[model samples]
Target: MKLSKNFTNPLAANNPVIVQILGICSALAVTVKLEPALVMGLSVTFVTAFSNLIMSLLRNGLPSRIRIIVQLVVIATLVIVVDQFLRAYMYDVSKQLSVYVGLIITNCIVMGRVEAFALGNKPWDSFVDGVANGIGYALILVIVAFFRELFGSGTLFGFDVLARFGYTNNALMLFPPMALIIIGCIIWVHRSINKDLQEK
Candidate 1:
């Protein structure tokens, strides 16, 4: 797979969140705030990209029977490195992210992309696939976070963005359920605008 082909596909045609519906957990859990959501997104992107790169390099040596084990090892190593870097340089954000950071290990999107695309591709192509999926996932989270922070809290990134107009916040937006609704609405709107995306 070519890097450009791999990268663009994830962002649109094969979006992990919208198309594959993977990584919805983080999209709901850590996206109440913009900054945290952004951090989580970047972290996941970094892990997925590098892990896929490593897996692509090792694809030939790994046995089919133990492929899951190989994938787990690669994912775990990448997550740990990301965790340590966050703890060292951005303790506060790291603390906010908490268990969710560790939960990256189980995020189906990361593993799915690695197994589905990375395993057979070259390192560069795999890396692009990771980035594309990460971005695809991030798009939903960021959009949801933008609205959740906006309406649920009357702020953007925790700063008051519409206070002067006396727009009080709705507490419901901060919860995980609201994120689902926001995401659903996003999908509806996206599909409505792009009729080609409509269900058959």
Candidate 2:
């Protein structure tokens, strides 16, 4: 496959979250606010890209039977590094994200791409695939967070908008179920636009 396809496909047609329905845990967990969502998105993106690169480089030497175990070890190490970096530089956000950062090791998007794309592709292509899926995941996160923060608290990244317009915040938006509702809405719209994705 072309490198450009690796880079671009995941942003839409092959999006890890919207299309593939991978990585929904963090997408719903950290997206109650834009800041946390942004941080989580970037963190996942960083981890995915680097881990994909490392895995691609190691692919040839990896034994098929132990590959999954090795992938987990590498992913866990990367997640810890990212968590530590966040604690050092962005303590508050780190605290807010809490266990979610560590949970990246379990994220289906990361493992899925690492195994499905990186193991079989060149390192550069794997990196592009990683970045592409990460961006794809992040795009959904930001969109969900934007709406959640806006309607839930009457703010966008902590700036009041609905309040200024004499509107009351929708308290339901702050809850986890709202995130699913938003995601479902996004899926609905996506499937509507891409008729091929609709159920028969």
Candidate 3:
């Protein structure tokens, strides 16, 4: 049951993005298009899962004073790997993502999980928590990107989805503030459904 909660909680009830408001910067920067948002989400998921696993494995022996430094090293190394991989095979998307890929190292969601859950949990449990939180973040990115790309550019993954139907692209949707607006709407809907999250 605990493992189930570890894996399931972040999907909605305890999402890193909307609920905890952890990684909103990337959501705003990359959600301008679906492809980059998808790539960014996957990149974060990989880094989070492995960083948590590594940190959890090392937690017992890690000196408390240097733990934050060590966590940054681990996360940075993983982010570099993802960045290089994207540059190699997905150059266009990598270019679109720009420095935001490297910025994942500083992402609150990644380091927060390492400090909060991975340090205390078993390796397997920590890995589950990381994956869950990463996916939760990714899910929001995808939703926001979907609406942004559809209305902002009248395209999804560069395909003309609505242009033929007399849809005039809304330039405003492509901006970062639009992403925040979409996220706000999502939070409102989420809280309405999950009354437990609502303030008394």
Candidate 4:
């Protein structure tokens, strides 16, 4: 079904992170720890899904010349709401996330979906596409964060799993470069398995 493809494609076959590589900066920035990555993922999914729905609803009436401006306004409003909620309810995590949470407004994944899919599709379809792409981005962030947090901090979600086994954590895994390396490895493995992605 078309709806199913919109939801499933971004999970693997058409992953925005590994395939399109649209939002790699956030993937690298927030993956040093699992908690932040999880929060970031949820926030992005929420924003993208709602933003797409909003854009799709407005598509017919939106003036072509000011569509980008309107899109930013809608996105900014959602980002602010999410940011404020984080600051109020999850102060410590909000502190850890810092401006990155607010930066969701500018994430290409969000903007791209709004422009490309939402502007031309029905509300339900655009919503599905937004969620799919957000999950695609989030999936990679979580994967990178899992490795980085486990090896880098000797813990999973701060539980100290590696320390239990008497293994030392690798400091390199705490760095941003390591996130990039892990993402690169994921892309390599994905492309290897799905040879259709290989360049002709």
Error of 2 at 104 (Å): 0.6
The estimated TM-scores of all candidates read 0.94, 0.97, 0.99, 0.98
The best candidate in terms of lDDT:
3
Candidate 3 lDDT, 1-200, residue by residue in tens:
99998998999999999999999999999999999999999999999999999999999999999999999999999999999999999999999999999999989999999999999999999999999989999999999999999999999999999998999999999989999999999999999999999988
lDDT of 4 at 69: 98
lDDT string for model 4 (22-122, tens) is 88888889888999999999999999999999999999999999999999999999999999999999998899899899999989999999988999999
lDDT per residue (tens digit) for residues 80-164 in model 2: 9999999999999999999999999999999999989899999998998898888899999999999999999989888888899
Q: Give the TM-score of candidate 3.
A: 0.99
Q: Who is ahead in TM-score, 2 or 4?
A: 4
TM-score pick, better of 1 and 2 = 2
Clashing pairs in 2: none
Point out the worst 10-residue segment of candidate 4 by lDDT. Answer: 20-29
Candidate 4 TM-score over all chains jointly:
0.98
Candidate 3: segments with Cα more than 4 A from true spot: none
Q: Between 3 and 4, whose lDDT is larger?
A: 3
Q: Which residue pairs collide, candidate 1? A: none
lDDT of candidate model 2 versus the reference: 0.92
